[model samples]
Every structure is written in C-alpha cells, then in structure tokens.
Target: MTRPETLQASSKPNYSSPDILRQFYQRLFPFRPLFQWLNHGPTPQPDFQNREFAFVLPGGAYIRYQSFLSADLFKKQCVQMTPERFEIGPQYSINPRDRKQLRKASSFRPVMKELVFDIDMTDYDSIRTCCSKAAICNKCWHFIIMAIKVVDTALREDFGFQHILWVYSGRRGAHAWISDKRAREMDDAKRKALAGYLVLAMSGEQGKKISIKRPLHPHVDRSLKVLNPYFQDEVLAEQDPWQSAEQAERLIRLLPDKDLTAALQKKWDSMPGRSSNQKWADIDAVAEAGHLSTLSAKQLVDVKQDIRLEYTYPRLDAEVSKKLNHLLKSPFVIHPGTGRVCVPIDTRHLDSFDPLGVPTVTALLQEIDEWESKSGNMSDEEKAKVQDWQKTSLKPYVEYFRGYVAGLLKEESKGKRSREEVAIEGLNGMEF
Candidate 1:
C-alpha cells in the first residue's frame, strides 16, 4: 500500500506563530456552525453559558474555568487570543459568573454532560513500530480505525446510544462525544463503570499487560469479531511482527504445549531466509496441528484471541471518560504540532477519514490568498463558497455536525409539546 503524504513539507508555511494563528482564527474559523453546535436544541439557551471553556497558549500556559455569555462572545475571545489549543469540559456548572459560589453551593448540582472517550495513538506504542509521538503513517493508522470500530459498535449496540459524535484529534488520536440524553445524564460513577467495562488491559511497568478470565463475555467476543479482520489483514500482513527474533520468540511462547513451541522454534531457525508472511504461515500451520492433536480447543482459541488483543484492542485514557470535570481539546482548534483542524469524523464513511487529509491553518490561508488573487467580479455562488468554511475541507464535517444538532432540536421540540399537552389536561381536570 502507498504511504500517505506527510504534513511536514518544505512548501507548507508555519502557522504555529501567534500572528498567523490569530489571523486564521479571525478570518477563517467557522463560528456560526460552532455556535449552533454548542447551543443546540429547543431548551433554555443558558445551558451553553454554563459549559466551561479552557485554552492552552503557545508556551504551554493554561487557562481554565472560562465561560462565554454567548457564541459571539466566545468567537471574539478566540479570535483575540488565538490559543494553540482549546478545550471543553463535559460537566456544566450552574453559574458562570461566580466560580467559587457555584462550587460551594449545596443547591447547585453538577448536572448533564456528554459521556466522552479519548483514544490516543501514543497508547499503542508497544504494538506499533513504524512511527511514534505525533507522527502517523498508513501502516499505523489501522489501529485508529480498529479503535473506532470497537468503541462505536459497543456504544451503539450495547449501550443503545444514538447521536454519537466522533472527532479527529488534530494530532495523533481521536475523541468520541456521545450526546444522547441518557448518556449525558449519567453520573461520574456510572461513567466510571462504563469506562471500566470497555477497558480490558492494565497499565504499569511490570506484570501481564492484558488479562481476561475464562468464558469470555459477549462484549469481548463482539469486540474481537469487530477487530479480527483488521488484525489478520493489517497487523499480520503489513506489520510483519515476526521479522524480529525477539518478537518471533514472544509469539512462540504463547503456544499451549512445549512440543509445539519447540517445533515452531526449530522451523523458525531453519528458515532464516523466509519472508515474514511465510514465517507467520508456518507458525499458523503448527498451531492448527497442535489444536487437532495435543492442544485443547480453548487453548488454541485463547492463543489467537490473546494475539488479537495484544495488537488491536482499544487503548483508552480511562481518566478522560471516567471524570466529569476533565476537559478535552475542543473540535475545530488547530493542533500546534500539525496545524490541522480538529475536524469531526463522519463514521458513516470512517474508512475514508484521514488525519493527513485535514486542512491545515496555513493551507486555509493559502486558499484564501488564491481566492483573493482572482478578479473581484465573481458570481453570487462563488462569493458564498469563498466566504465560509466551504472553501476548506472542513465543510463536510461541519455539515454532518449541523445535521446532528438539528436532530436534537427536533427531539427537544417534540418533548416540549408533549409536556404542554399534559399540563393543559391537568388544568381542565381542575376546572371539573
């Protein structure tokens, strides 16, 4: 497979500088759609004001507990500061004016918040070998795709959540925002339970990394079903883990019987010239033979399942999902390292969503430059296209987001009418 283009080309202008970043935010950021997204639905408009906003500056300086009275105000502040990163908190506080009073008051309750999940590529360091840090290549991108499939499936099928939003983390990961009413109302403990249920691996310097008991639960089984295709095609064929002797030996150690391990090791030693794919084929044959002869069915199943889990299971920042107060990098903010917009991912066509393909701040500016260079006498259609985010690759993602918000608003309106009808019936009964 061909490798995707890198973001660090010589021709690309640096947008990390404060001046260019400020201009980009002022001239190009889609404030209208963002306002609609945050203030969605037919309920009280003050809900958007209670949501906390945070910013991360150029030199690693942090700002928190910031609130905006309106989307216009939020947009103005963003254009003025042009923060390198912007974050939104899951929990909404009662009062935006007095933070201390809001926290201290017993009457004030920490109410609704979207159940969020953060999946960072750095967490898969042990499994991937191509690139590390913020760098990503096509070979390593399968992990992200697998992560999305697993989580998306579980969230929709198991938890019965609709209106899920998936956003590409401008740098090396992705985030999921579940806006279903039931999900938003869940407390911290319930969120913690959900996070725990999704995670099967433990993190530490020592001991086994992944542990699952016998009689594997259906969730794990379903995840494996979702993960197996990518594991076989991408991890096995493309990654070629058996190329290194250390890695090969690790695979051999997972075999159930000593004789089968010895057989595989001898075969491996004899075939020093074999390709990685051929070596894997030999190991697979031996494992299959052992299953028929000495190994029990469970042993063979466990070995294969362990291999899949080791390579492709979702590695989550459990804290992000568990804590209500934790803030996540907001969508549409430019990542300092990559300069790409934190655009939403339309999971309907998830396979086509590429991080490398996201429009960078520099690129958007260049697009504007090109547009301005043209003759001033353009048609109405062309003018409209050039003015908004339609000129950039962010159009589709923003449209998808707008559609989701519209759906929520429709539901909210329906609920309001139902409540009004019930109230009218109660008044009539009182008169009688």
Candidate 2:
C-alpha cells in the first residue's frame, strides 16, 4: 500500500487534501466496528441501514439524508467522496433516500438516537482565564475533566445508564454519547427533560446572579460533591478568574446580602493582587468578622454553594442534547482543523486522557509505513494477522470500540430474546 504523497517526510500534513482523506477513509477509519456499534449487531438492521448520515464534502458542501445498506457501502461512499468529515443523525422510520416517495411527510421522522451532550471550551470562556474560543491547554482542560466526572456519575448513578462513550472532539471540547437502549429510545421530550435535569436550570452567563435551592437536589448535591475538589485546584488556583478587581465583582454579585457583598468587596479592594483562592476565602472571613450578612446561616451556605456551582458545574450545550435529529460528528473522523482523529475517551482512565496527544492522520499513516519497513524479517502469515490500525497508535482506540460494540450487541441479543419470549407467552394465553 503506497502512502499518500501528502505524508512525505519533508512536507507538512495537509488533512484537507482529497487524496489524503481518501487514503485515511480507505485505510485507518474504523467503518466495520462503527457499523456494528450503530447497527447493534453484526447483521444490518434499521439502526444502521435506515440511519441518516450527513457529510461535509471536501469542497465545503454539506450533504444530508444519505443512507447506506451495509458497512461496505458506507466505506465505499467515504473513500469515494473523501469528505472532510461526516455526521451521524438518528435512524429514520424509513430509508432516508426513500423519504420523498412516502405519501405522508409526517410519517418520515427520526425514531432512535443516542442521547448526546456537548461540552465546548467556548462555554467556559468567562470562567477560564487561560484560553478562549477553540483554544485549550491542560490547565483549562480540567474543566472538561470536571465536567466528565459530574455528568458521567449522574448518567450512571442517577439515571442508571450502563453504556456511555465520551469522545474528544479533536479540538477544545468533548462529546458524550449514551448508548443504553433506554437512552436511544427516548423521544425529544424525554431528551429535553433529561438534559434539563443535568444542566443547571439558571442563567449561565457571566456577571449574572445564579441561585440554588436551600436543600440541594440529590443530583445537584452529588455534582457539587464531585466538583468540590476541583473548585480549588482547577478553578480558583489554575483559572484565577477573579484575580483582577474588575473581575472580582462578578463573584461579589452572587452573594445574596448587599452588606455581605460590600464587605467582601471592600476586603478585596484593599488587596487587588489577591488570588481567586484568597478572594474566595475572604468571603467567609469578611462575612464572619464584619457580621455583614443579612441572610440566615442556611441561606448564606446556599449562596456559597451556588457560587461554587456557578464556576465549576459543566456548562453543557443543552440544545444538542434536547433533540433527536441533531447530527454530531462521527467518532474517528479526522477534524480538518487539527488533523487529529476524534478518538473515544476511555472513562476507565478518564483523568489521564490528553487530547493534545491524540494521533493525527498523517502520523498514523507514517506509523503503518514504519511498521512495514521494520517487519521485513517477519513471515507473511505473521504480518497478515495484524490489521493496519493495529500497526499504529490507533490500535487501542479501535480495540476499545470493538469491545464496546461487542458488549452492546450481546445486550441487544438478550433484549430481542426477552421480547420474543414475552410475545410467545401472550399467544399461549389467548383462547381459541
């Protein structure tokens, strides 16, 4: 397999090239496993066959309503068109291509899709002092890390969802795809309710006052507990969002009592250079020493908790999670801007995931060439055992995906059998 010319040793990687994209789709992209994941079994089903795919072509044309009968057909289209990226939408009731032929337009609709949540770094712009608008560093990435911890915990412990997949968006954000049968089967109303349950039901903008109930909701309590540790280390220390006196006012406004905020402001005013950590501490110190709080003790406590949540809670793109037909970028697609493959983030080792360290398309191709050269002494049988993805850094991610798909298929098989048993039992109960 000759490598694409774009991966030459001297030249820089150009992911936008159609030839390079073609090679990537033909070689590294994990279409079979992806198909098995969406199809929910080895064989084609409505989950995969009737699914809608939208592609962003190399020339920047966005084409939607594309459907494929099999994994091979999907791969063929990807390799032929060499799209910059493709998006996965819900499985329609009828084949997307045949929708126009249907007598009633209302009959053509999205049925099932994984409930997804998006956490963009842009959402954290006001809270994070490090970077803004599509730029992220390790220090700022803790926000994402904190988000995953809180949201993942809620999805599992609160909602009892079993299979959740988190993927780095190949740039300054991460996406969550919950693949539990119950999750996928939920309608738009249920999706909205679930998303609303997770995301704070308050104004998320900066310099605005955010309030929380006195007795915290169980979900909110758990999220707060999960976020408390990171508040000091991630937000107050690393982000230092209120380091400047001008910025400190944002924090001051959240306090319920005017006298308390004035005292806290006065303290922070004298020491403008105090870090966010110190300023946060000064809230308690000033409130106690000056006796300025008009709020009850519980109200003061709730106010502080609200302040903590304001800075640390996951700022999800709730709109993305509230719709069944909203298309999200496909896993393993190369982000044209970053040249990185959008790999799944293994929650088992969540804290250690380094988005910046993910493999790029050109580098993965180079790995294949290097491995072929290094294995000159190996027998044909030995070399044939390994897939191209196995020869590169992409092996672990693909293997993880394969394993996840296998588990899903097994559960889906069980679900089918259980439903069949119930139906047979109902027939036996019927009188002739």
Candidate 3:
C-alpha cells in the first residue's frame, strides 16, 4: 500500500531516506521485545516460524509469505531491507518455508489466527462532517475510542476471551488483535459468525444501509451504553446534525406523533442560530410537556435507535474480522506519510493515547544527531542507553506489551510438564 498523500509539505519532515530508516531499524528498533511479543505462550516451540510476514517497499511494491526460522533471522532481514511498512498475516500457514507447495496444495491449512478487527475513520464519513478520508482531529478520534471500548467489552465479556492487543494503524485507523488461545483457534466459520454478530449496521448504497430490530440484542445494548457519553458530547453537541435542514427533517419525521414533529420543527425553526445541543434541548422540553405520552413504547425506542444509527454504532470493515489471510500492518513500522511509528495502545489509558504524540522517524533521527554531536565519544553504558527505546515516549507502550506477553508465557508454563518428569514417568512404566 502507498503512503497517504494527505500530509502537507509543511507538516511532514524531510528525513525519509532509506539510509535514515535503515539506521533506525539496525540501531534503535526494539527487535528483541517485538520477537518476545510474537513468540508468546507455552507451545513446544513458538509459532513465529509458521507465521507469514509481508513488506511494502518505498514505491509501493509488495512482498508476502516471508517467514523466518528464528527471531535473529527476522531481525537480520528487517535490518537489511528497511522496508517502508510491513504487515503480519493473521493466519499461520502450515508450511511457511515452501510457499509454492503450500499455494498449490489442494487442502490448505490455516491453523490459528488472532481475531483481528480494523476500524477506520473513513467508515464514519457518512456521519462525521469535521473530517474526511485519511484526515483526523480530536473530534473524530472519539469514534475510535468508542469503537475500541465496544469491541473490547463484547470480546472479553460475551465471548469469554482475553489477551487483546490494540495497535494504531499508523494512519487513520486502529486494529485489535485478540491473541487469546480460543480466539486464535477459531476456524473461518466461527470468525464469520463473530463478525456477523458484531455488525449492527450493514454496508450498501446510501439509503439502504442499516436495518436494526427493536429490543436491541444485549451485545448492541451494551455497546450503546459504552457509546452514550461519546454520542452526547461529540456527535449531538459538537457535530450538530440538526443544523442541516435535511438531517433535522429526517429526525423529526421519525417521531410517532405528527403534532409533536410539527411542534419540534417550529421550535427548531425559531432558534435560527442556537447551538445544536440547545435546539435539541428545546425539542426535548416540548416532548416532556405531555407530547411524548402520545407515542408508544416502540416509537420511543425507535427514536433512540435513530439517534444511535446516526452517531454511536460501531462502523467496522467486516471483511477484516471475517478473513483469516488478511494482513494487518505490523506495530512499530514507520508510516511513510506522517513518519510516525505504529505504536501499541494501552486500553487502560485509552484516553491518553494520542496518535499525534507518537514519535516520528525524523524526530528520533534529530535526537540521535543531537546526542552524537554533544558526545563525540561515549562509554559502553552510554551507548547502550542511547540504543534503548526507553529514552523515547514509545517505551511505556512497548513495556506494557512485554508484560502482557509475559503473562501469556506464565500461563503456558503452568500447563507444561518438564522433560525430567516425563522421563521419570516413562521409566516407572517399564518392567524390569
């Protein structure tokens, strides 16, 4: 994939050369930590060798099915190529080494994959008026936060899976990798089922898009609960859909009582320059004055649903969650347009995770330049410290990912029997 062209000349830096990127990959990239994360858990041998990796070169050329026998090998290849961006395949191929044989095989084997979800801002273009395409601001970012919470809660509580890895998309989206054993073991059918279940809004042409029933499913209900605050603050107050006459008319037409709709329209028209929130409040006051009593329970529910359909419901690229072979951008790869590293997100501090705050390659190179200029010669300890990613803002996120993977390893070890124990059991079973 090509880097986005939305980045203006003044906003982007100039250190996008192959040399600077190669130096970053060789000297400063935390390969060891990344390897530990990918090699998580207690199998006889971790599945990194079986996993498929792909790279996107500077001119948008793509490479796929590239596997490494070990972390050292993977590190070596990355250091050698210094790719513009890279992606990790969701599915593990049965034979990563013999790519041609695997492709030609009649019955393919895709043993496991972390259930991945992709949420892009462009999906919300229908609702959001502030930004479009790859552009984003704080107002639009609230949608991402809502998406994470809704999906995270459903996966953890409803599906009974844990160990989710959330990562920034390096551009205009976010990805969630549910690395729990059960999630990874899910077949294509199960993955499709989950994707279908999560989809409330269907995709199609403009007018025929969504169809939701009354008495929302507990999953959607729970998601709406998570979405309530963001909708009120970001969409209703800030976006002010009611500002558009067409949008306001549509909302008014949804009301069950014709008299109430007319009243709301009149009230809305009188307040020519009022804030969207204020206009909405005036309409609510009219409803409360005995006008709302005319509507049935179903109508009231539909009104609330209409509001959600316009603002809070999760807009997902269903194919991302449904497919096993889909490749997602690897974390820590630099986004060529913005030059920012695709960092891992800590959901506990989701509010604090800002895409703008991520370190760009240019910024890191500048830091290195300053460091080299100040100290012509350095001690071993100083050299090590300079190489450590801990000197940057990305340190805490990497450490958080390391701790999560460490927990998975600890869990895996608990179920494992040592070689000595197995040997003793074998000996005891034999007759003299």
Error of 3 at 37 (Å): 2.4
Top-scoring candidate (lDDT): 2
Model 1 TM-score relative to the real fold: 0.89
lDDT of 1 by residue, 73-167 (tens): 88889878878878887446564446576436665455667789999988877667677776787788778989999999999999998778888
Q: Which pairs, if any, clash in model 1?
A: none
Against the true structure, candidate 2 has what lDDT? Answer: 0.88
Which structure is stronger by lDDT: 1 or 2?
A: 2
Worst 10 residues of 1 by lDDT: 202-211
lDDT (C-alpha, whole model) for all candidates: 0.76, 0.88, 0.73
lDDT of 2 at 50: 95
C-alpha positional error of residue 127 in candidate 2 after TM-score superposition, expressed in Å: 0.7
lDDT of 3 by residue, 227-344 (tens): 8788789888766766776667656654557767778788767766666677667656776775665776466556656566557777888898887777888878888878887888
lDDT of 2 by residue, 1-432 (tens): 111113233565678799889989888999999999999888899999999999999788999999999999999999999999999999999999999999999999999999999999888887788777877778888889999999999999999998889999998899999999999999999999999898884444556788676578998998888899999888898788989877887887777688888777777777669998988888778777765647876677888888889888999999999999999999999988778999999989988888878899989999999999999999999999988899999999999988888888899899999999999999999999
Clashing pairs in 3: none
* TM-score between model 2 and native: 0.94
Clashes of each: 0, 0, 0
Q: What local lDDT score does residue 217 receive in model 1, on the 0 to 100 scale?
A: 88
